[model samples]
Target: MKSRSLQPQLANLPNYKVRESHKAKHVNLKISPHHGLEVVVPKGFDHRRIPEILQKKQKWIDKIARQFEAQQEFLTPTAADQGVTEIVLQAIAETWRVEYVPTSNPHVVVTEKPGQQLQVRGAITHTDLCHKALCKWLAHKARTHLVPWLRTVSHEVQLPFEQASVRGQKTRWASCSQNKMISLNYKLLFLPPEVVCYVFVHELCHTIHMNHSAAFWQLVGEKDPNYEQLDAELHNIWRYVPVWVEH
Candidate 1:
């Protein structure tokens, strides 16, 4: 077993990835419905034994992978799947109307208008193009909405950072650098307000303490008492993201 401390370590396997969490008190293997196999361990865990452990759990991993594959097959939509004409920005509590217009050239142009309407001009026949336009618009919405929200939270909590940015990350909701710069996943716009606030406070605490030490979590708890619940809720929020904008 590794020494108990802070900071998680990532180990990529042949088929999946393992994230060793410092807070983990035991050797635990999790098979995510979205991600594949993840191995969590207490800090100071034996790094060389991961392969052996995975080999021991191969059958379980295979079973879980099959289950996830079946679920994804059902959840994944076709390109022509019901065009997403309306969406709700849960983080900001705003309902948006999405309008799609077809164009001749293979290009997508998105314009944000008044009255919570987004105009997507592109090759509607090309669902890929339409999806692209919608994705671009989502990013724009995050930049316009999330970045400013972070600034406001920083001010409210009196925890200032150098700057903030939004990106389309596949595996992370948000991150903070040693230089005090924070990067937020644009998909956070899909999460509820409380969960979004928890994420912001989590990263903001990172600016002061880079690791999830006792002191760090103490600060987070002080800010948001329900952070534990909110953090747990984040694990399943991907299902709420509009399918077209997820890519």
Candidate 2:
């Protein structure tokens, strides 16, 4: 029997990357910062067809490239006149302790405790490393606490999820894919449990409706009537937390 193939089409407008990955053997498209088109084929896939594909997609590629350029310009951050000091890692570590105290400087000093503590020491030269460590620690905590809460909320809302995990995501607090995979950001740990539940339910509802249409919001509101207010509070409260960066 002939193997099934994706009926590739000439997109009227420019699209993103057309690439293949071991994770996704199927032809996939993604938007990257630099490359306009990334075509990925299987090991035995014909390379000769690539040029034809590109030609067919030339108009789309050009339009998407221009849009990407415009978006890049808008996303550029203004240059800072002076360097901003990063939060101290020690202070972050100390914050986890029961009797943690913040010093005059942005450092967290911890009192001796039986269990582990989170500390933030802004004095550390490698701010990125410190921030990553902090994010990891926060992720661990969220995973421990949020999973059970998610299960309860899922049951209450009569929504089912295949799997749930926590990570350090920058742009989104939580997301649910079409496959019912749910991910929550470690930064969510900074929010109160009520707010966290609001985010969890919001993402969980996505498993039912993939887009943010009025129906999606209605589903979210059905679970938690005050979801909108809680979501707004979460965003406002999390604004004070420092951004997580990798070393």
Candidate 3:
């Protein structure tokens, strides 16, 4: 990680911190509460071009910064305070408003209620149990959406895998095993549809080339023309995941 002072050329741009991430495939801009503005660059990215890049993206950076400022001031209660109020599965384009009801049952249960809502009943007072129940529901949703999506991509790309499973991996988004089994992260539900497709294609390509060699990249490009940008977006998309899922 490197933090650069505002240079004369960057005087017009907002001061930002730069971080190198192994997952990043291209330069990406991120705005967070703790860090006002961040420029995530690849390992060998040229630092000298950062000023020019920031200048090019000045308007977008400013817009996101303003939104962050507004969020910080008017931040609403989250799972930490009460319970998860909403869950968004962007990969499937679904938004579920959550409702909590205290019940006499010993364990928490999350069930789909009518009108795009989820009802969490039984032991709602136990925040940990409620979160765990929600996480289980999220995995179920991932299987319902992601498994079929991966199968579709595999059919289209002509890359076949033996089996696919969902997991909550801390550092990996998805992986393809040696025996042609694939594991996808449930957190992928938070990413955009296109990015999720890229992950699927990435793992499917691994069935052909296990390593990220030139041949692997060529295959990925054939499947996803916009993979470079989508891959870079992954490094910044973890912010979209709800805190309850991580907890």
Candidate 4:
């Protein structure tokens, strides 16, 4: 669908493409890094009304869209850019200068150098292999930094979970099960420390309230007073994630 399909009331809004899904029960609007201004609606909903719904949420949409552009600049560098040269991990408060060298060998090799530098050699010309090697190192960083960090936060917040697992989740930042198990996204390394703490507090509350009811949000507020603001930030947290990691 085209922006022309929208009602005249939304003429001022940016053009948005539409997609209809039978599985969808409500209208959903969000900006994708690769696809801008996408609107998904139930198969039979009045398409004209989408503009009104979007108009009402224009402020949020614009805010999130702006974030996508300003997210980790290295994630989508400019035309002159070659590859990921350096990475700064705010959650861990560490920055690594990177160097890549192509080799005739088939396997990629990585080494952590002095002065906060990293050397990647072998198959450097192969983007897929290079990304794989980088992600493997990132997982190691998550285990070294995120796991212990979560435990420390859980202790400080007085919410001891049974277990914690980190992963490359594309859609979710974290989740807690009734069994007291918690799973977190490794991409969280890209977010600010305070934002990361908010995700933990959110999931830890799930140990008490699985449903997102008013009571659940109240519990989150008690733990993190800025839960509302943190929740809003999560809407476009993917901006922090590097495109090379493949989520």
Instruction: Go through the candidates in order and give the C-alpha RMSD of each one to the true structure.
Output: 6.7, 10.6, 5.7, 4.7
lDDT of 3 by residue, 165-185 (tens): 999886578998889999999
Q: lDDT for model 4, please.
A: 0.77
Candidate 2, residue 164: the lDDT equals 92
Candidate 1: count of backbone clashes, pairs at least 3 residues apart or interchain: 4
lDDT of each: 0.74, 0.57, 0.82, 0.77
What's the candidate order when arranged by decreasing lDDT?
A: 3, 4, 1, 2
Better of 2 and 3 by TM-score: 3
With a 3 Å backbone cut-off (N, CA, C), the pairs that clash in candidate 3 are none
Candidate 4: give the clashing pairs: none
Candidate 2 per-residue C-alpha lDDT over 11-31 given as tens digits, one digit per residue, 9 for 90 to 100 = 533343334333334443333
Q: Please report the TM-score between candidate 2 and the true structure.
A: 0.52
lDDT of 1 at 2: 29
TM-score of each: 0.75, 0.52, 0.70, 0.75
Q: 1 or 2, which is superior by TM-score?
A: 1
TM-score for candidate 1: 0.75
